[model samples]
Target: MTKTFETYSNIQSQNIRFRNRFGIEVAGDLYLPVGYETQKNPAIVVSGPFGAVKEQVSGLYAQEFAKNGFVALAFDPSFTGESGGAVRNVAEPVMFTEDYSAAVDYFGTLPYVDRERIGAQAICGLSGMALTAAGADTRIKAVATTSMYDMSKSMYLGYRNGYTDEQRAKLREHVSQQRWVDVDNGASETGHYSSGYHELGFNADGCIVTGESLFPEKLPEDADPVSKAFFDYYCTPRGYHERSINSTAAWTATTPMSFYEFPLCHNIKDISPRPVLFVTGENAHSRYHSEEAYEAANEPKELLIVPNADHVDLYDQKDKIPFDKLVAFFTENLK
Candidate 1:
């Protein structure tokens, strides 16, 4: 069970649970305006910076939405956080996409939610997942994304478009071998989260692996921009949550196996007529992703870049989230 996190004073939230299509129970914190008494309210289901639980930035966004007169829900993806999973901290691209539609189903059933006015948003890795979900689920009448990364591209190609075809091939080979090893070891073995930077080592095969750092403890000022921004949020009191994957633990070793041939974002054009908003920091490392998605999407789409900001800045940086624009976009389209 998720303890309800604090948010805006005028926002009220409740911890709730619902079953996904697979009959797995998913946990969420649903937020509503303090005096909300209307029936059939516009709603949006929100999630992710990938590997994140509902307790972090997603909760902040959900509460913000509630304060602006929308029913908002933030949930843990399957196999993570308080959500049900046989093996914890695993990432399933397909199942994650399903979670959005499941959320829409839950919203439609609620008496105070406007079933036809439902929308969805994703932050970070879920950016691409929201695109896929909105394209496939018409119930999602509008779509929004912030500092988005296509999980598939990040998996095979690596961050910032690093990693060549040859490198990706080598990575795939290693992941497959790791998969077999896990199966041989009863498939109950878990892997640690991405070992942090400044830590360096190598495996028996000579492939570089992360190890504890011999350098003095890293300060946010000395770290790279992306790492610094994220660390300040996830590693400090600003945004840290015990259940967050990025904040504390690593994912299962075989989690990467799910993204081998994944190619999402091709169907983004299908979400036309319905308004779409793509928000990214002007300097976000993942900005190209939103640019490509914006070009692929139809006229109803708008891309808004936060000036002087980076990917992680939008995670919880109130000054950078553009709540006015978000409220306007959803209000106009979800009508």
Candidate 2:
């Protein structure tokens, strides 16, 4: 516990667990504002970057938000990190969407929390989940997302809209067939193409070895920039976590099977009367997602583009992330 506190000396926090709607125990670290629970303060819940655990960028944001006077909670999504669930490291969109609302449920019971003034924030793939939750759950009064990516879009349409209808049809066929093949397999099913990255370690020259070395000494220049950036963060001390699926395991084999059916961007306008702040890097590959979400939303919304930044930059690049904007947005709307 002391060791954990040493990692982030800027704030005070406590480990907590709460039961979700499914009665699963969700683990989190709640950052309390200075002076220790003296007031019923506005609170924020944070999560993100898809398979990332709370110990990484989410915790960074939570601790910073706490320093700025709002109590903040960062939790692992179900089936990931310390959160309780059957299978491990899988992305179930519906259940992941529910995790935010469940965090709200936990906040309501905290003596230091002003439940009426609650907000939520996320980054990358989880950003779309945060927006979807805020749209459906009125309890969330404001939503903020950085470096947003629509996971469903990534699954069905492929990165940057590169996949064709014919390719998608083949993908659907592949997933449907796997469902039958997995009936008796129990988390060990096959036929997934999450290939290319297998092993993770460090070489003699301190170069991070990710997978079977598609390139011997350096990453291929033609590799997807966003993925390369993710590797830079999760493969080094910048934001690595042993429990994070991004750091320790390859993308889930069944990721496409569950994610293709759930499009989180469908009802972006539903959260009106409630405010939203969408933040994305100017150079982010997923910036289009935040742009489309902002356009679809009703009034009382904002799209903040950080100059000279990329998708993963907002994850742990504290200097690059507009935390001031976040503090101001939550303060104004969560009042």
Assess the local accuracy of residue 2 in candidate 1 as a C-alpha lDDT between 0 and 100.
41
Q: What RMSD does model 2 have?
A: 5.9
lDDT of 2 by residue, 33-62 (tens): 886568889999999878788888888889
Backbone-clash count (model 1): 2
Segments of candidate 1 deviating more than 4 angstroms: 1-6, 188-222
Worst 10 residues of 1 by lDDT: 192-201
**Residue 6 in model 2: lDDT:** 27
Distance from true position, residue 221, model 1, in Å? 8.0
Q: Rate the local accuracy (lDDT) of all candidates.
A: 0.79, 0.79
What is the Cα root-mean-square deviation between model 1 and the actual structure? Answer: 3.7
* Per-residue alpha-carbon lDDT of candidate 1 for residues 1-335, written as tens digits (9 for 90 to 100): 24334556667888999988998899998999765675668998999988888988788889888988899999999988999977777788888988999999999778889888988989998878889988888889999999988877777766666776767767777776775666666655543332222112245775745332212235645566766777777767777677877777666665666776667776788888788999999999889888888999997999999999899888887888898888898888889
